[model samples]
Target: MKQFLRSGVVAATLAVAGVSGAGVALAETMNVTIVAGHPPVFRWVKHASQTFIPAVNKALEGSGTTIEWSEQYGGSLAKVGEELEAVEEGLAEIGLVSSLFDPAKLAPQNVTYFTPFVVSDSTLVSEWMDKLQSSNADMKAAWEANGLEYLGGAIGIDDYLLMTNFPVKSIADLEGRKIGAPGPAVNWLKGTGAVGVSGNLTTYYNEIKTGVYDGVIVFASAALPGKLHEVAPYITKVGFGAQYAGGFAANKDWFDGLDPAVQQALRDAAEADRIAYHADLDASVSKFLEIMTSQGATVTEVDEGFRAQWAAGMDNVAKVWAEKLDDAGVNGSAVLKDYMDTMRAAGAQPVRNWDQE
Candidate 1:
């Protein structure tokens, strides 16, 4: 997934055209392809791409620069774990990359997903991320070093919950259960003694049906689209908390090559997409819950004490992650602290600190 920018080829092609131009000849249309690991029905990635592509085209309407899109959703272009590298290597011009799935590449920022019960409000989460991106230099460098540029991001779904074949009434109920969790979510299995099987929202259905696992930890918004209610009817809101999910990124060289106006337009479009996508997700939760319940899913709210117990059970993986990154010469601890401070200022109450709490 590597893309090479050939300035010499462009210049040679322009010279061969017999148009002796003193200035660079810009293309009338820019063919931009956006890739998503999830299916088109996933709200965050789907709606963001849907909202951005049109707004970008509208911004370039009279500029004679048309924005064309090629969306490869449902892991068609890049699988769940391959998004970060796919974008870094320019497999697609732009892509929706998940930090949780690519911890090795995203590290400190990905630690946020591992820190349970840190932030609950999606709006605050999204707003705080915006502030972090603007003020945090290390955060910027983290992405820049990967040959990518972050436009902006959206908060995906709400807090995660456990949807299982058996009702989760207590922490002890989880013992010995083969639970399906994403890579970052495996930390939740600590102390509970639950057998954690790594899986994503995309694979939950088939895995659960085939008896690969007894239950799955996922957000209702995403689980609804996959019809998870039918198979796993017991829903326990264990408060895994809100995740930053993923965001749009482009090849740095390709992004820098764009005109300033076009660059601003693309950024503006992505910001708008972030707001709209989060709002849509916040609204969709209740609607999906109703739909899921009507279809015979038993939705239960876990006791607040139990939720706290679960949050406390997982070790502060953030510090472990930061130390790992520090060994690699990356300033992960500072980035994590700055993000936590910004989130707190934005009205978020973190349950623990990555450095010291």
Candidate 2:
């Protein structure tokens, strides 16, 4: 579950004396290891191979540098939630780190999850996060402090939808039920009369089938593959908004040690990877929904009134979240307001304005 390899070393060997008395230049290759906690079932994982690795290779094609990729994914390098440590420890050179799972470590990156119902478009959410990470020093420092360099921007999971076995007509149906959510997402269920269990997509199916919990807050991309529809067939498009759960990052030591051109190549490839992943995910949403429905899943979109009820009913989690951050001297309040304003400026209309309220 841990590994490291120099990613794409540009080996230029000077002419060496041989028996023939002719010096030969030897080409050096950098062996770059890329890793992820989730398997290829997720679009991010898939693109890490299909889009990112190749893009990195392509970028270094004529730069006298070639990346020999050692792709270790699906928890082979790090299990779900352990990727950050793996990369930070230099166990792996690069990895897709799940910020959502590492709340204490990556709290600033979870801004979207704290302020829900802001935007539902995955690409837009990702683009905005990219902007924020670059424009805000704290955001970038979060990664640097952790000894990791965030590559490109950040990638996102699709808009979250409620998937459960019980019919979710309104907030009433969910009362007294145990619903699973990862990290801060549990707060979204506040005042909804449902107990939110700390859970991840990997365990949703088994957990739901065994009746460990009633339902889960999940997205179509994972729900279809996890086959959660079989156990939790009731799907609700509650507009929880997309999130920056995880994205590309490299160990600071490894990244800094690489040649500048190679580093730039990796960064460029990661950016291309961001674009490709969003496009693929956007294209797959409807298909996955159809597949799940065909497999007997029931789907519904909560009405505007219902959405407002749900959003308004929740405790002021955003304000509380900001206060906690501010008390820690982390500027959580400013981050919250800035995120809300950014989303609004981009024409987002949340069911409840998390910051203003």
| Candidate number achieving the greatest lDDT relative to the actual structure | 2
Candidate 2 lDDT for residue 315: 89
Query: Which pairs clash (backbone N, Cα, C closer than 3 Å) in model 1?
Result: 1-89
What's the lDDT of the predicted structure labeled candidate 1? 0.77
Per-residue CA lDDT of candidate 2, range 228-335, in tens?
A: 999998999998888888788998888877778888988888889899889888999999999999989888988888888888888888898888988987888888
Q: Model 1 over residues 1-357: C-alpha lDDT tens digits?
A: 255533222223555567665686565656677888888878876775678887788787767566657788888999887877877877777788787787777765565675677777777777677556557776677778788888886545488888999988788998899999888787778878799998898889989988998999898888899999888999987777787766777888888888788888888888888888888888888898889999999999877788778767777777777777778988878877777777777777766655565
TM-score of each: 0.90, 0.93
Off by over 4 Å in 2: 1-26
lDDT of 2 at 66: 70
* Model 1, C-alpha of 327: deviation from truth (Å): 2.1
lDDT of 2: 0.84
- By summed lDDT, which 10 consecutive residues of candidate 2 come out lowest? 1-10
